[model samples]
Target chain A: MRDFRVLLWLRWRQFSDGLVYWMRVLGYNPKSSGFFEKLYPLYLLIISSFWVFAMWGFGHDNAVNIGSNIHPTSLADLLKAIPPAVLILQVFVIIVALRSTPLKLSFADMSYIAGSPIARSVPVLLGFLRQVIFRLVIIAGFFSLFALVLTRPLAQNIDLSASVRAMLACIPLVVLTWALGWLLGILRLVYPGVSRWNYLWVLPLLILLAATYLPAPFLWPGQALVLLIYGIAPWWVYPFLALLAIGLVVAFVWFGNRINMILAVDESILHARVAALGLLAFRQPNLLLRIRLQSAAAGRKPFLSLPKVYGFQTLATRAALSYLRHPFMLIFSAVWGGVMAQAAVWIISNELPVQLWIGWLLVVGIAPPVGLLHVFRIDVEERFLRQFLLVDGLQLLMADVILPLIATIAGAMVVWLAQGFEPEITSIGALFIPILAILLALCGAVALTNKRVLQTRILATGITFGIIMVVGVNFSPIIAFVAAVLSIMTLGGMVSQNA
Target chain B: MADKSQEDGPLLKVADVSFKYGSLNALSNITLEASPGQLIALVGRNGAGKSTLLKCIAGWTQATSGEVHILGQSIKQNERFVREHVVLVPDTPPFYDELTAFEHLQFNAQVHGWQDWEDEAEELLRKYGLHANRNAFPFAFSRGMRYKLALCMALLIEPKILLLDEPLGPLDPVSADDLWEELNGHRNDGMTILLSSHQLPQEAHPDRYVIMEQGEIIAQGSPDGLRKSLHIEGPLSLDALLRSAIKSRKAVKADA
Candidate 1:
C-alpha cells in the first residue's frame, strides 16, 4: 500500500511536470504569469467542453436520422452490429495484452520500484489499475455517446432511462474485458516461460475465428448488453456481468501477486524507451514507429530475403522484403483503405451530406496511413544512408511505396466493388481509388521531403483538395485525372529537387 | 599554371569558409587545406566548430560564405560528385533498422557498384570485432559497435577525403588505438583524413593539428611547430595546447 502511494505520487509529479512543459511551450510563464496565464487551464477545459458538445450534437442528429428516415431498415443491422463490434474490441484488447502485457513502466519506475523490497504486486497492481482506469474513461465516454444513439428518444420514443441503463451495462463489459486481458497478461509474467510461447498473441484471434463457428457463449455478453440497452434484458444479466467483472479482477490481482519484476522490466524496455521521448513522440510519430519496429524485429529472423538485384530495383526489392517481414504494416494499409472506402460508400449512398464529407476529409487529412511514407521517410531522413543510394527522390519514393500502394488499392477495390454501386458509379469509383491513394502518398512524400513535416502535410492536403475541387468540378473525370497526374509530376519534381 | 595546380594541389581545400546558425556565427573564416597522404587532427573543445567545419567540407551543410573544394571542384556546385568522393561519419551515426550489421556494409558495397564484396565486408567486420554480431541489427548494438560499423562503412567506400567527427568518443582505449592504426594505414594509401577530437591517444600522431576556439582557428601547425610556437613549458598535450592557445589569444586581445 505504501509503495503504491509512493508510485502514485511519483506519477503525479511527472504529470505535473509534463503539464508545466506544455504550458511553457504555449508561452505561459508561471513566475511572471498574469491572469490570462493562470486561466490557460480553464481555456483548455472550455475548448474540450465545446468539442464534446459538438460531438453530442452530431451524434444525436445522425442517430435520429438513421432511426427515422435514412436507412431505417439498417437500424436492425446496427443493433446486430453492436454486439460483434464490442466482441471485436475485446478480442483486440486481449490479443495485444497477450503479445505485450499492458504493464508500462517508465525508466524512473524501473529504477525506483522494480528492484526494491516492496511486494512485487504493488507495481503490478498499480500499473493494472492505471491502465484499466485510463481505458475505462475512454471506453465509457465512447459508449455513453453510443448509448444516446441506441436510445433514439426522438425517433423511437425511448426514454432517457433506457440510455442510462445501456451506459451502465457497457461499463461492466469494458471492465470485465480489460480485467480478463490483464489477468491473462499477468499470468505470462508470473510464469516467464509462457512469454516464450511464439505467436501466443494469435490465440485470441484463433478463438475469435472459432467463435464464428460457435457464437453462442462467445457473443453472449454482447447480446446481453444489447438487450439491456433496449430495456428488455432479464434482471439477472446485470448481476451476472458484475459478478464476472469481479471474478476477473480477483484473478488478475491473484496472478499479479506472483509477477516477476525481472520479466516485467524486460517486457517494458521498449515502452520505457518510447515513453522517455515524451512530447517528442507526438511531434515525430515516425520516430515512435521506428522504435516500435526495431523492438518488434529485435530478435526475430526476417521472413523474407532481399533479392540480389542492382540499381533502383534493389531498393524496391529491399522495401518489398521489409514489408513482408512486418506483415502487419501491409495488413494495416489494407484495413485503412477498406475503412475509408466504407465511409465513402456511406456518405455517397446517403446523398453526400456536407457534414459527412467534411468528416471524411478531416479523417483523411489528420490520419493519412502511417505506412504510406514509412520507408521513404527513413530513406530521406537518414542522410548517412541516403548518401549511399544513387537514385533520385522520385525514384526512391516510387520504389518504396509501390507495394503498400498496391495493397491499399486492392483493399479499396474489394470494398468498393462489394458495396454494389451502380455499374457506372462502380467503375468511376474504381478509377478514383488509385488516384486518391497516389495523391495521398504524394502528399505524404512531399511533407516528408521538408523539415516541417506536419505543417507541410496539412498544407499539401489543402492544396491537393483545392485543386481536385476546382479541376474536378469544372472538368470531366478524365480531365480531373489528367490534372491530378500533372499535380503528381509537379510534387514529384519538388521531392526530387529537394531530395 | 591552373592545369599544373589542379594536378598537384591539395585534395581538400576550404578557402575562407564561414557558417552561421541564424545570427550565431558557428564557423568564421575557417580556412584549411589537406593534400593527399596527410592526416590532420582538428583539436577543439565542445562547440568549437570542428564538426561544423567537417560538415561544410563534406557538403552535408552549406557554408554561409566561401567554398569547400575537393579535387578542384566546388562542393556546393558539384555536391553529387563531391559526395561520391567524401564520407562524413558523425558521432552517433544512424543505420537502417531493418538491416543487420553485415547487410549495412553489403548494401553500401552493392550500391556503390562493387562486385565480389562479401570477403571484404567479412574482413572489415572481423577486424572491428563485430563478426559475431554481423547478423544482428545495428540498432541493437552498443554505441561503440555502432560507431565501429559506421567506420567500417566509410572505410569500405574508400573515399578520397574522410571526415570523422569525435570518432574516439564512443570507442574504448584499445579500439581507439586500433582505429588510429587503421587511419594511419589509410593515410599511407594517400587517403586524406581529417578527424575532430578533444583528446587523442597519447601514442597517436597526425601530420598536422588545427586547433580551434569559439568557432575560429586559434592556432594550426605541425604538432612540434605548435608546441614550439605556443611556448609550452611542459609536456605537450591537448590540454596544455588548448590552455596555451586560449592564454595567447587572451594576451593578444589584451594587447590590442
Candidate 2:
C-alpha cells in the first residue's frame, strides 16, 4: 500500500510535468496563463448552461402537456423505458471516453513512468484512477444538467414518493455505468493494439435498442424490481438496489484488477502482437500485397520486405492500410451509393424535373470531396504528418494522398455501379473534379498550417467548400473553370513551397 | 569478488521497463549492466540492439525488463538517483525545432528541476562558442551545431554516468575536440561515461574498451590489453586494431 501510494505520487508528478511541458510548448506560461486557465471553469459553466437550455427546449412543451393526459400508467412501463434510455446514454459517454485511452498510453510515456523508481502497480492504479475521475466528472456534470430539465416533466407525472424512488433506482444504474466505463478505459490502456474492442459503442446501442423494443418484463430485472419495491416496500428496495450497485462497482474494479494483472504478466504477448501488426505491417495482407505490387510494378527495390521499412514510412503505410482495410469504409461507400441511387429512383418515379435531378447529381458529386476531407482528418489525428515528414515528402504524399485517392475513387465507382450508372468514358470525367478538389485541399493543408493536420484539413475543407458552394450556386461553366484553375494554382504553389 | 571478475555478470541491468508504439515494442530484455566505469562501446551495426541498449541505460527506453541496477540499487527505484546519476545524450539532439540553443537550454533546465536554466544554458552556450547561432532554430543550425546542442543538454543534466550513442558522428574537428575536453572534465569528476561510436577513440587515452561484433561482446579490457591479446604493435590506433581483431576473430570462428 505504501509502495502503491508512492508510485501514484510519482505518476501524478510525471503527468503534471508532461502537462506543463505541453502547456509551455503551447505558449502558456503558468504565471501568465494562471488567470486565463482559471477561466476554464467559466467555459465549462457556459457549456453546461447551453446544455441545460437545449435539454429544457426538448422538455418545454412536454412539461406543460404532462398533466393534461394523465393516463395513470402502471409503474412497470415507466420504469422499463427510463432505465434503458439512461443505460444507452451512459454507454455512449463511456465509449467516447474510452476511445482516447489507447492514444494516451503511448510507449514513450509508459517508458518514462516504468523507468521511475515508483512501484509498477501504482502507475497502473493511478492511470485507472485518473481515467475514472475524469469519466465521473464528465458523466456527473452531463447527467446533472440533463436531470435538471427532466425533473419538471418527471415531477408532474409522478408524486414526490415515486419521484424519489425513481431517482434512487437511477443511482445504481449510474454507478454501474461509471464502473463499466472505468473497466473499459483500463482495457483500452492495457491493450491499445486491439482495435476490435473500440466498438464498445455497439454494446450500449444494443442495450438501448433492446430496452426500447424488447418487452420490459423479459429484458431487465432492475426495472421490475424497482416497480415491485416502490409498490410493496420502497425503503427495502432502495437499499437492495444500492447494494446491487455497490456489488457491480466492486465486480468492475475486481475485473479491472484481474485484467491489469494478466496484462502485466502477458505484456510481452501484447507487445509481440502489437509489434507484429504495427512494426511488421505483414499482418495486414491486403496492404502487404499492395506494397509488394507497388514495389514490383514501380520497379523499385523493396526496402526491407516485412519489417525493414522503419520510421515514418512504416507508420504512414500502416495508417493508410488501416483506413483502407476497415470494414466501415466499404459500408459507408455502399450506404452513400444507396442514398444516391434512391435519389435517382425518386427522380424517375416521381417524374421530378430534370433540373432537380441535375441538382441532386451535383450534390452527390460534391459528396466525394467532402468525404475525402473526413479521411484527411482521420489521417491527421493518427499523426500521419509526423510520419509523412520522415519520408521524402513527395513519396509520402503519393502513398498517403494518391493511393487513398485511388481507393476512394474505386469506392465511388462501386457506389456508382450500385446506383446502376452505366460505364461511359465521360462518366469517368466526373471523378476528375472531386479528385482535383481533394488534391488542392491536401496541398493547401500541408503548406498553410503548422497546427495539427486534422485541424488544418478541416479548416481547408471548410474554406474550399464555402467557395465551391458560392460559385457552384451560379452553375456557370466559366465559374467552375475559374475555381478549378485557382485550386490548381494553389496546389502548385503549395507543392513548390514545400519543395 | 570472483563473480565480479567473471564476464558472465551483466555489464548493465534494466528493470520493469515498458515502451510502446501507437501500441507496440520498439524495445523490451532490457536488463543490462556494464562493469564499473568500463569504456564499453555498444556496437550492433544498425538497429542490432545497440541504440536500444544505450537508450535503456540513458533512461530513454525505460526498462521493460525487471530492474536496472547500476551497482546494486535499481535506477528505476529512485528518480533523483537516475536523474543525477545517469545521463543520455542521443545521436540526434531531441531539441524543439522552434527553440534556439539558448531556449533549449532553458527547457532542459526546467526538465532537470533547475530553478534558473536560462542563465545556465546561456553560460554553456557561450562557453561552447555556440552563442553566435544560439538564436537559430535547430533546423537552421549546421549539423555540428546540433551536435553541440546535444552535448550542452547532457552537460546541463550533469549525470555521473553518461550514455552517448553515435555522439561524435555529426561533429566537426573543433566540435569533437570540444566534446573530448568536456568528456575529460567529466572523467576528472569521476564520471563514468559509456559511449557507442563507429569511430574508435585513441587507444592510449581510454581506461578500457569493449568491442561488440554481433549482440555479443567479443573483446573487453584496457586498450593495451586488447592490443596485446589481438597481437597488435605498440602505439597502435584503436580503429585499425579493432578491425584486425574482428578479422582474426571471424577467421577463428570460421575455422571452428
* Top candidate, metric TM-score: 1
Cα lDDT of model 1 by residue, A385-499, tens digit: 7877777788889999999999888889999999887898899889889988888888888888778877887788777755775676688877777877888888889887777
Q: What is the TM-score of each candidate against the true structure?
A: 0.91, 0.36
Cα shift from native, residue A238, model 2 (Å): 10
Candidate 2: Cα lDDT at A112 = 59
Report the first chain's TM-score for all candidates: 0.91, 0.42
Question: Mind giving the per-residue lDDT tens digits that candidate 2 earns over A366-468?
Answer: 3433223333333333321121122333434444454445545555455455545456623543544355435544543463334444345445555554465
Tens-place lDDT per residue, model 1, B72-178, is 88877676777688899999999988877887887788777777778988988998899999988898899999999999999998998899999999999888988
Docking class of 2: incorrect
With candidate 2 superimposed using the best TM-score fit, by how many Å does residue A342's alpha carbon deviate from the native?
14
Off by over 4 Å in 2: A1-126, A136-178, A181-245, A255-262, A265-400, A406-445, A448-459, A474-493, A496-499, B1-256
**Candidate 2: tens digits of C-alpha lDDT, residues B155-231:** 87676577877877988766677678778777777667787777754421666565655434556667678777888
Every model's TM-score on chain B: 0.96, 0.75
**Model 2 complex DockQ against the native:** 0.02
